[model samples]
Target: MQTVCNIEQLRTVVNAWRQQGLRVGFVPTMGNLHAGHISLIEEAHKHADKIVASIFVNPMQFGANEDIGNYPRTLSDDQEKLVAANCDLLFTPTPEIIYPKGLENQTFVEVPDVSVGYCGESRPGHFRGVATVVCKLFNLVQPDIACFGLKDYQQIQVIKTMVEDLSMPIDVIAVETKREASGLAMSSRNNYLNDAEKATAVNLSQTMRWLASQLASHNDYDKLLQQARAKIDASGMKTDYIHIAHARTLEPATQNDKSLVILAAAHCGKARLIDNLQVELD
Candidate 1:
């Protein structure tokens, strides 16, 4: 895949693709290539003629104490993975290029409501950084369609809300969360886990799944979520949250809400793990 670090070069290639009557699909990521990221490109292949992937470890999305400096960077390995996934173009811009005016002065995008609570509460200004960088990428690449992994259930909702509120014409596709055989969702942060921590990590997804099964039988949202959180804490991880919410709006789930999502975030070792399970009631 051809990699470009500047907007001029990226737009030049994009315009050339447009002139060729090619439909473009974009996948924006933060390097440390894994199966979850590759699945996005693979999903994009079905929707567009050409695929574009970007790897910029967005500083805005990370919290003040978060691991921005230590976030994994494997450009060469990521490039090989992208090429193997049949990605046509890769945009690997520097933070300077992304926030030319500096983040303090950079024009940012915020999708209200959906951007509140959950990760929004867990990481203040996190979605602002996410929306801003994604908005910038959307403008820079201007693809006909973009793909995001559903592992980030709330994030995909925020992006969808942003696109609709802003009236961006691109189609946003949500791909299923890629997981290991043990049910641990694939994540760049998984690299932080030691052998023992990795073993405990799968319990995050296990707890989520167990919560989902409990939801299937009844609608005792608060009790179920509390039990799930306790279960996670017992697994040797500190629970951040284990909430059952409306799948679409992300408001706390109710008995009347047919569509629901169980989201959990916890701290284990050097990694903070997140996982979710979606349910559609009959």
Candidate 2:
């Protein structure tokens, strides 16, 4: 696998691939390789002639008080994982390399109302950072298809909206979230969990399972939302938000719909965990 750390070099390689008439798939990540991220790489590998993955811990996407400084930086390990997955190119750029100079003057992409809910509401300017950086990467890598995990359900929605609004040519593919056997979604933050905390983390996924049962048996949206909120609260985790909405529109469902997503984020000590379940509402 070839690894390029600068945008110019990446673009040069991408141009060469384009000249060869090869299709490229891109997977953007923050550098902690887990089963979930590998799942995206696997999907991309299957779909494209070449797979390009990026591992940049984007500072812009992090909040002032967030764990930007402490977020894991395992480049070598990430490279090994991606290479094992048969990734063609790994674009690992530094912040200065990506932002260059006068980053403040650069145009940004934002989704108005959808950006105001769930994780976006909890972390101000979070999605804006995500949007700006993703747009930049799309320009840099310029892949035919970009793969994103559905672990960040709202994030997938935001990126899809950004791509549509900007008319980017890349197809945005949503890969399913990989979870532990206990049902806890795999996350880099899972490292922060102590033994006891790991058990508590199981509640994050269990809550989603319970809601799926609720939605499956009946079509009471409000009741399901209320019960979910109560369950999360009673689980001793401070709930950020529990949303049962139409997967595409992201609006709260007034009636049972076919595509439904149950997303929740909560705080467990210093670790903020997010998990979601996408299902057919039948």
Candidate 3:
């Protein structure tokens, strides 16, 4: 796999591929590669003639008290995993290379109100940081298609809006969240879970499933949120939020429908895990 750190070199190589009539695919990630990330890369490889994967631990996406300093970084292992997945190109740029002027006073992209709830409410400015960096990467790679895991369901929605609202030419695709046999959604942060906590972590996904089953019989949205929240709280996880809402608008659902997302976020030991299950109440 060819590793290009600078933008110009990567762009030149991609342009050469395009000139050869190759369709390009892109996967943007923070390092500390896992099976979930590899699944996205594998999807990209299947759909495009050339695959480009980027690993930049975006500093702008973290808040003052967040885990930026403690976030995992295993670039050597990450590179090996990408190469084994048959990735053609890897762009692992330094912070200075990605944010030359730094995040302060930098022009950042925001997705507005949708950025105000769930994970965004718990971590202020998180999605703004996400939107800006994602836009930057999109411009840098300019691939024919990009792949994102639905483990980050809200971010997927925001990016969909950003691409449609801005008319970005790249096609955005969502890959299902890869999970463990216990039903815990795969996440890079799962590394922080201790043995006992890891076992209890399965409740997050389980609670979401329970919510979907209840939605068919119960019409009370507030009660649904309360029940899911109680389950996570009882699991000994530090509850961030548990919500069932319109999958597209993300507004709290007033009645059951065919489109909804049951989302949850919590802290177990030092790791913060998030997961969601989509429901069709038809």
Candidate 4:
């Protein structure tokens, strides 16, 4: 894979692909390179002729007390994985490259409502950071399609909302959430878990699945949410939120809503993990 960190080089490579009339696909990530992330790259392959993946650990998306300093950077390992995944291009821009005048001075993009509640509530300014960096990357990459993991269901909603609100030409797609044999949603943060915490973390996904199964026949949203939250908390993990909401809008699911998603987040040992399950009621 061709690696370019310079903005001009990235544009030059992408523009060449455009001139060749080759449809381009993009996957933006914070490089720890796991199966879930690779799945996004593979998803991109299905949509476009060439795939471009970016690895910039966005500081704006991180909270003040979050693990910005300690977030793992395995660029060498990531590059090898990307090449193996058949990624055509990789952009590894530094914070300086992205925010030349500094983050305080850079223009920010915020998508309202969808950016509220859930992770947005738990981590203030988080979605604003997300929208801004993604907007910046969208402008930088200018791909025909961009793929995000379903593990971040709310995040994909935020991005889809942003794209529609801004009328950006890019198509945003969500790849299915990759999971372990035990049903744990695969995440880069999963690395933070110790052996015992790793085992316990699977409970988060399991609880979501259990809630989805129950919601199939019973639409008691509040009761199911409470039960799911209780199950995760009982697993020795602190529950952040276990909410049943509209699959597309991220609003609280209503009785008339047929398409729904169970969104969840929790803390296990040193890692803060998130997962979701989508269900369509009859």
- Write one digit per residue (lDDT tens) for candidate 2, span 34-128: 88999999999777999999998888878889998989888889889988999999998888887777457666677776777888889998999
- Which residue pairs in candidate 3 have backbone atoms (N, alpha carbon, C) closer than 3 angstroms, thus clashing? none
Clash statistics: count for each candidate? 0, 0, 0, 0
Question: Which 10 consecutive positions of candidate 3 have the poorest summed lDDT?
Answer: 249-258
- lDDT value for model 3: 0.89
Off by over 4 Å in 3: none
Q: Mind giving the per-residue lDDT tens digits that candidate 3 earns over 38-144? A: 99998998889999999988988888988989889998999899889999999989988878887786788989767769998888888998999999899999999
**Which ten residues in a row are the worst by lDDT in model 1?**
211-220
RMSD to the true structure for each prediction, in A, is: 0.8, 1.5, 1.0, 1.0
TM-scores of the models, in the given order?
A: 0.98, 0.95, 0.98, 0.97
As a whole number from 0 to 100, the lDDT of residue 248 in candidate 1 is 94
Give me the displacement of residue 5 in model 2, in angstroms: 1.2
Better candidate by lDDT, 1 or 2: 1
